[model samples]
Target chain A: MVRLITHNLLACHAKGCTQNNFPLQFKDVSIELKEQEVNSEFVKNFLPRLEWKALVNTARQLGDTSLPEELPDMVDDDFLKALHHVLFEIHVEEGAMVCPNCGHSYPISNGIPNMLLSEHEIG
Target chain B: MFETPLTNIDYDKVYEPAEDSFLLLDCFEQEYQSIQQRFTGRVPVVTEIGTGSGIVTCFIKQNILPHSIFFATDINPTSCSTAAETIKLNDTHETHPFTFTAMQMNLTSAVRSNKIDLLVFNPPYVPAENVPEIPKDLDDSSWLDLALLGGQDGMMTTWEVLNNLENILTPEIGIAYILFCARNKPDQVAETMKARGWKVDVVIHRKAGWEVLSILLFQK
Candidate 1:
């Protein structure tokens, strides 16, 4: 159940892999889409906190071709729908999120990710 | 001396006012799902101490529907009233049956003897140099004394909440999720929760700028 925003901050917490450890790549993924009522005002307000490029790229990887190549000047209904889908609708049910830098894998089982690292992985 | 009108100071403007916190509201979904997975279909009555804007409450109403009764409280009467109004406005056209009670109560005075199903709180856990002055109406009441500030170390309110848990919480209840700012003494909070005979787990953690936020789920 890693939200894109949560996924954004998650990097390989493995020792000494701090540099370039972000934008973790998702693998063997399963997602569930639950359509929540579109709240455009909320989407408009959330734009500032999002990693736009990362979100666009990740949504592409997940086969969601809803967002535009660049964030639009105005948040129209189309844009808000896309933003809502990418942010709230899609859920990572099961997958292994691997850190690009440290190559550490956090496994997701039954929609929950096991983020605990072994003794050696803990700094 | 000139007095400032409370309405002139926009409460919503004080917050970052972005829906990102609403997106971060999704973090509660993960927490909710995890609880459901662990508990398996038993939904408890939930009470959120500081139900800021009702974002998380709305999430609960939408995602974990049918099993939970939600009661949200805040020190700020305006915030509580606004949250209640928002919930009412959103649920008007929908068929989602939810009982949301919004009350203006301070955390310390808010706790009751009844055992709650789930206790959720996002307290003022930020460490600040000076505690912000309370408004004229809330001057005598410590409830609105900066809902985000936890004293010099940012754990004063948290400690107070924990101390009062014995009176408010019951052993029959399964879980309580307390989201605290990472910059504060989280370990101390964890240690305190542990000392109180509850199993503490760090379910979700996010870092925003210099401050980090963690969702800690405490189970009896």
Candidate 2:
């Protein structure tokens, strides 16, 4: 599924499209809120690996404005819970991840992102 | 032993779990303590490339790292679809903070640099006259050939992942378990990786009929 955690690790790999390809922009996405157990430690452990700005921007685009503009110094229970929800709960069921650099669009159907490029698009 | 996740898997398209897959499972089971030790302080971002049926990743999640964030990728859309279903069906630990996401991509091309904490690959190790090319159609049945027919030496796909290892794996604690058949020249491959400063170990090996399958554990 296209969770924020997975989206955080994705970048466009189209041929010769090297600049500003990260955090593939989501368009026309249908989100599903899956009920998951919130583990504070798990969220905290993954906090460093997160691209805060990209995550915040993506979450906002998906209509979730829970995270702050910048990561807070103090990670309280409320913040961890919010981070957990954003990373694990929100699943992009159907959508398209468009690259900002090359304008290549990867379609998402049934929660799986098709990152396959055409022959002409392969690098 | 962990139960194999085989639900909704289309064997005609996705490569079925055989000796190579089971050998990986056995290696993980034997080295469970060391594997757990590698991720003692943090939650790992575990990814499996060429996840045919998602059994290997599912086995790790169920038996070893239940709290990890899992990702599975395959070139075939049908394999990705079936693997997703397999993950969903075997997700019994609802209380653990774990999630499995499947992606249809070529190797780790789209995955971020140095983000994967643990990686697993059971690549196509059969020596074929011609390695099948990746098809543009996501649902093409020809994608199955890409899953079984490795290049002349059965190392074309495996080398693709190895050459890009530094970009995909985390520097310190990243670990990878990759399967190789005798035709792929496992020892020579191990020597090359060792020369590059990666700690390599042949965790387990078995003579499965015509194929001598072995799993190589690599740490950087």
lDDT for each residue of candidate 2 in B1-220, tens digit (9 for 90 to 100): 6666656767777878878778888888898999898898788999999998888888898898988989899988888888888877987656777878899988888988888999999998889887798776755778778888888799988998998898789988888999999989999999999999899999889999988899998888
Which candidate's TM-score is highest? 2
Residue A83 in candidate 2 has what lDDT? 92
| Per-residue lDDT of candidate 2, residues A1-123 (tens digit) | 799998999999999988899889999898899888889988998898899999999999999999999999999999999999999999999989999888999999999999988779988
User: What's the TM for model 1?
Assistant: 0.54
Interface RMSD per candidate (angstroms): 16.1, 0.8
Candidate 2's displacement at residue B15, Å, is 1.4
Q: Candidate 2, which segments miss by more than 4 Å at Cα?
A: B136-141
Q: Evaluate model 1 with DockQ and give the value.
A: 0.01
Report the backbone clash tally of model 1.
2
Q: After best superposition, candidate 1 residue B10: deviation in angstroms? A: 5.0
> In model 2, what is the error at residue B140, expressed in angstroms?
4.9
TM-score of chain B of each: 0.78, 0.95
